[model samples]
Target: MKPLDTAILLAGVPLASPVTLLSGCVGFCEDLARMEGFDFSAVGAIFLKGTTLQARQGNRPPRVVETQGGMLNAIGLQNPGARHVVDHILPTIQHLPTRFFANIAGSTVAEYGEVARIFDDSPVDGIEINISCPNVKEGGAAFGSDPKVAAHVVETVKRVTSKPVITKLSPNVTDITRVAQAVIDAGTDAISAINTLMGMAIDLEKRRPVLGNGQGGLSGPAIKPVALLQVWRIHQIAGPRGIPIVGQGGITTARDAMEFMVAGATAIGLGTALFRNPLGAREVLDGMVAWGQRLGVANFHEIRGTLNQP
Candidate 1:
């Protein structure tokens, strides 16, 4: 099947395919774009690395440690800040074939608003509020873990930008639906579920935590089950409200993307898999086409939320 034949829309943004490059993995899209056979048009969207109001040095050494099925990372939202990205990066990449989404994070609600406002005036196709970041004013508690805080961030950013606001929800919560509902009520245009779960590894030889930061977000195949469940749950709540879901976590192949779509994800995000293969997106799109052909699925949307239960 043709790539366009498998196209799906997310929050009014037309994706050539349901596959998208997750934030923090593509390095502003330049990394994969440089790959020999990488095709940006094969994927639906590209989420740039998380950007804060100001530049962050990120955590110390040993920020990433590989695990059995995934890796642990506490990169600390390292970036060149919103202003620099707006001035330098976006201009160079604004002409890419696919939609570009800015992933913005901040320590305070006002800062999140400021970043969103900056990107709003830029050429980005949308804004994804990274509410999973620790709220400094709230004693390092993640904004995504609390419905109120998450809602406030969404409300603040929505007030400043006309672009679609996609709230990236954290998996480290009791009832993911509560947070999803809160953000939707606060005017978020869409939801991206299951940001890496917080976790850590240990160095048996050194007798210390593996990551420089005591804890890091766990991502890759390990979190696929958890992410699938979260996407399904969020869809149960937001899907009825006309809000789309970006299902991501441990997605490495076409089968993985199909599982997410079948569970209710309108779009799938590929992150950790990129580390293993820069051209993973193209392969995923191919797999989806093959799968669609086998199942006689004409449109990719047909498989969404089609989970069978007795």
Candidate 2:
């Protein structure tokens, strides 16, 4: 067992692993199921691709481009909609070794609650409200950037489902910690800190934007500084209260993982790097294990909140 493998208690449910693979684009139908059988042993669980009420084809070509330290993607939020995911993806993953956390998106508050209620009856372990998807026109950025709307969405979904709810917040706000606290007050089981930061790239040669959407969510190592700031802030304010913080955004190595832990993140999520190398997720996990051994820590939990000062 890895050092981070101490049993995790979430709303009275015990989880075997603390590492979760973050994804927003699992293929259609049995594709997710096949991926699960082959990769489930590598991590604690997988957050399947975000699904919408209606299927989306996402953005146009050149939607993705490589940047200085990290890559930028404008893949949009393309998925086969909720009905197809339910009939096709859920069945295959329901029996995997790791639990399934479904990320649902929409253009309105009602849509968030509507889709969450469906997962309540599925074999899902939890629902992660992805309110920070920049490619979408309706729900994502609108809900996440506004503290009142962010809290409202969580409260509304909580009323409809018993599943442990995780609200993924946006980093584009003026005050990230304030937004994090908004959802906490709304009663979320966990707060997934530091979603991709909003950024743009221009093609000087053509006098146009790089992505079809004109702008895209900035992910990877470039945003690590901003992401670290947000995660640390949440740690300072929320850690003592027992709320679990799931850190993401620009984590590429075991040391990066350690920073999140020291910043008081309970768990870490891997996103953009997975596209560059399929082994990205496994490498991070293995690195953390190796780091723990060198540090002479028996259980990784002891490293939590190492930076907080009373």
Query: Best-fitting candidate, measured by lDDT?
Result: 1
TM values, all candidates: 0.97, 0.90
TM-score attained by model 1:
0.97
Q: Clash totals for all models, in order?
A: 1, 1
**Local distance difference test, per candidate?**
0.91, 0.76
For candidate 1, what is the total of clashing residue pairs? 1
Model 1 misplacement above 4 A: 1-4
| Clashing pairs for predicted structure model 2, backbone only | 107-139
**RMSD (CA, Å), each prediction:** 1.4, 2.9
Q: On residues 236-289, what C-alpha lDDT tens digit does candidate 1 reach at each position?
A: 988789899999999999999999999999899999998999788889988988
Candidate 1 to native Cα RMSD, angstroms = 1.4
Query: Candidate 2 on 6-87: residue-level lDDT in tens?
Result: 4455434455555667766344324545553455555666777787878899989678878888877777788887777787
